[model samples]
Target: MEALNLLESFVRSAEAGSFSAAARRLGITPAAVSKNVARLESQLGVRLFQRSTRQVTLTDSGEQFFQQVSGPFSTLRDAFASASQDAGKPAGVLKVSLALAFGREYLVPLLGEFLARYPAIVPDWHFENRPVDLIQDGFDAAIGGGIELTEGVVARELVNTHIIVTASPAYMKGRPVPAHPDDLAVLDGIVRRSGPTGRLRAYTLRNQAGDEAQVAQCTRMVFDDPEAMAHAAMLGYGVALLPTTHAAKWLESGALMRLLPGWHADNGPVSVYYPSKKLLPPKTRVFIDFVVDAFRDREFAARFGAP
Candidate 1:
């Protein structure tokens, strides 16, 4: 077990490029992680890493050792974990990446209930607007829309991400209400630039009656984040296209009103993504199940689709 711990600390540190980050993933102190690596190096009589203030780089011998040991070590760990999980509770640091606004509003609120249900698992969640490389970043899971479906990763969709045109009541107070999708062209538009592409997003609105209209709003404000766009709309900046997940609370609070209510854009579904591992970790599996069940119980699928 001690040798396994030492190996795990070294592998995690190599993957993370920093002792502190490896410690966070291992649920240990940085000093402990460093000591483990040092111990491993002493046993092998090889200097494994070149350490600096900000990060660590693997030495040539260390890289070779890592390549030799990592795969076998992972298989061993998974086998042991599978046996343990059959008899014991799921326990470990469960790291997840989440979309910023939606995660804060929807997922973060479920933390209390989740922790109560699985007290042995520690949540280390990162909230960001961009899609993350789950394998490279060492995340157990991620939740968002439009994430690239990379090889070895699978996405279980939670909700249909629908976008609706919205504006604050104050913004529309003296303005002509858009009776059709074409009417949105003359309104002040709070536009969004694609974070990954660095280009303006062109939305094509659709109605239930099988009509499609390319939305070309008069650009007034530009933003890269949905949360920022929602905030700007609430502050009466302009009409904006928002996903129901981001606009739900504001719309409920009367801070924003849906415009062209019958028209919407269907982006891809917001999904919970995880690696397609044969022996998925117990903690990751449980978290995915919990999120799915929570969505079902809360009717989040229905709520995030139309509102």
Candidate 2:
């Protein structure tokens, strides 16, 4: 329908940040894209964007509407793309970004099987330690721990990840292992500097009454890399807070011992996020579904030693 076309055009314009860019991508004139978006605004009874000669930005209402409509629109697009596939083959470039450590430990191994299954799909993988802007950077998808999705992105929770306090056997040799969170203040601790904030590592601990209390202030060494922190902890640096997934193999090998087991912080979930598009390419949909199925299997917990 014309309304649907207008909606698609508006979304593309907003994403591209310019009618000219949208026009080129859509294979239409810039004026046509502008008119289509104007028609969309009229029908919606709200000005979705504020435009000037220099820039185009979404209005507050536009941002809200985009968040609600983007996912459904992307789903509908994926459905259409799935129906239109020829010879039962999916073809397209799937650009994905992921954190370095998580990507190396989990996604890299999983991607080999994925690539083998979808030979027609070309995947471009970017591994970084920091978050990248999905729309601005032109990434189709991302796999990361945090769910800090932008306005026009959709996130699917894949797994629940927990943080554990850990230290090497040498570090625990002389000192009594911390039995509770509050006891951490007296023990040596290695801090991660690149977390949500560049501050001391604070963890959730339980008090004597079995209620949760926050232990916000005890640190001896700070490191930017979590792997470094783990290594430092292994060398008897101090207790380090790490994701359970990252520390699982080390724990199993007796290289690292979990400290204050009852006081570990429960981080919400790990998710795959992608920009909302009118038609999600078949490859992206299949990959997302595959990730969901792979993570939700009961054996996944046993394999990862998730608690």
lDDT of 1 by residue, 1-307 (tens): 8999999999999988999989987778999999999999999999999999999999999999999998788778877776776347888788899998888889999999999988988999999988898866778999998888898799988888788999999999988999998998889999999977889999999888989999988999899988899999999999999888888888889999999887898877989999878788889999999999888899987777762
TM-score on alpha carbons, each prediction: 0.83, 0.71
- TM-score of model 2 (CA atoms): 0.71
Highest TM-score model number: 1
Candidate 1: segments with Cα more than 4 A from true spot: 13-68, 81-87
Off by over 4 Å in 2: 1-86, 194-196, 207-209, 302-307
The alpha-carbon deviation from the true structure for residue 154 of candidate 1, after best TM-score superposition, in angstroms, is 2.1
lDDT of predicted model 2? 0.77
Candidate 1 vs. true structure, TM-score: 0.83
- Model 1 residue 31 lDDT score: 97
lDDT per residue as tens, model 2, 101-212 = 8778877778778888888888888998777777766677898877477787899987777777889999899898776677778888788775657766556754335688
